[model samples]
Target: MSFLSALRRPPAAVRLNASYRATPCRSVSTSIPAASDKPAKASATATHTISSCTEGTVLGGLNWLKGQAPVTALADEEYPPWLWKLLDPKVIPDDGPGGQGEKVRLRKENRKKIRDVQFMKTQ
Candidate 1:
């Protein structure tokens, strides 16, 4: 079957994604204060920001609880081995280096070739 035919719904039965979990009802008294209620001072904001900002983004797996995720402290261990090549590039780059040098080099080369090209109309 083609791509559209493959995606077409079955006439017999329709499958639905039932991945939702039953959330516990919390008491109104336990709720945190509104953003406006928090202190407007820079120091207060900075401290909160530092605490909230969990370094080394969650990749490869599901992060159900972002605050208390199973993410390792050392990013080098958790992250893909090739990611380092992009972060800290080598002389002769390995796969997925995605180096800025290559783009710059290509752009420069293209401009030079364009300048050198002689059109019959211009001549």
Candidate 2:
């Protein structure tokens, strides 16, 4: 038989379910409160600011339930004057002898080279 003629034929037998249990209905309270009677407020009071420690560094996170805002990171392109002053060694004291200096020096040395792969091919 041709493809079009085969498609027009109906299949053998079809089974159908006549009954099924539907979902249970939820009952709601019909009692209504008076306009003058206010709803009870939250039981426990929240702290606006809470001090916390992270890896020996002191930091603060906000408690939004008390209506305080959280601190955010400064954008990569934006450099504040106070931040520049902070970066200067004379202002912020360096950690003793062999700590952060080596990592900072390595990063500075690596940054001096051209990063693009196209530049690497020329050399």
Candidate 3:
């Protein structure tokens, strides 16, 4: 018997469906900036060097990836809740860390600077 079946686990399809239902998808803007200063030809040429492997090659690699228990392998509750949370996209928070501060520090360094300035003013 398969390990999953031996463990009396739910089928992969059912787990995937439950995970999909629990995750909320945010719209990702794919529009490119038209006002970029870089020359279009140069950017296009740079992009040409970045490539995806053949679908067959990717599929072949999946067996190894699956064996390694790739990122989403935590549909099983036997794993830690943290891993389960990460794998379940439906648990995504709209205002979670990645939602903002992509290029910014979330910490309020400004507050520290303000406090320093106030201390100086009082002194």
Q: TM-scores, in order shown?
A: 0.20, 0.20, 0.18
Q: How close to the true structure is residue 22 of candidate 3, measured as C-alpha lDDT? A: 29
Candidate 3 runs further than 4 Å off: 1-99, 102-107
Q: lDDT by residue for model 1 over 1-123, one digit each (tens)?
A: 654333233212223323432222211212233446547642332111111223443222233475665532232345465533442335644334467767666788998778777553378
lDDT of 3 by residue, 34-83 (tens): 44567764443221111122222211112333457322222233445453
- For each candidate in the order shown, give its overall lDDT on alpha carbons: 0.39, 0.37, 0.38
lDDT of 1 at 115: 74
TM-score of 3: 0.18
| lDDT of candidate 3 at residue 27, scale 0 to 100 | 19
| lDDT score for residue 105 of model 1 | 69
What clash pairs does model 2 have?
A: none
Q: Among all windows of ten consecutive residues in candidate 3, which has the lowest summed lDDT? A: 46-55
Worst 10 residues of 2 by lDDT: 50-59
What's the C-alpha lDDT at position 36 in model 1?
61
Listed per model in order, the count of residue pairs whose N, CA or C atoms clash below 3 Å is 0, 0, 3
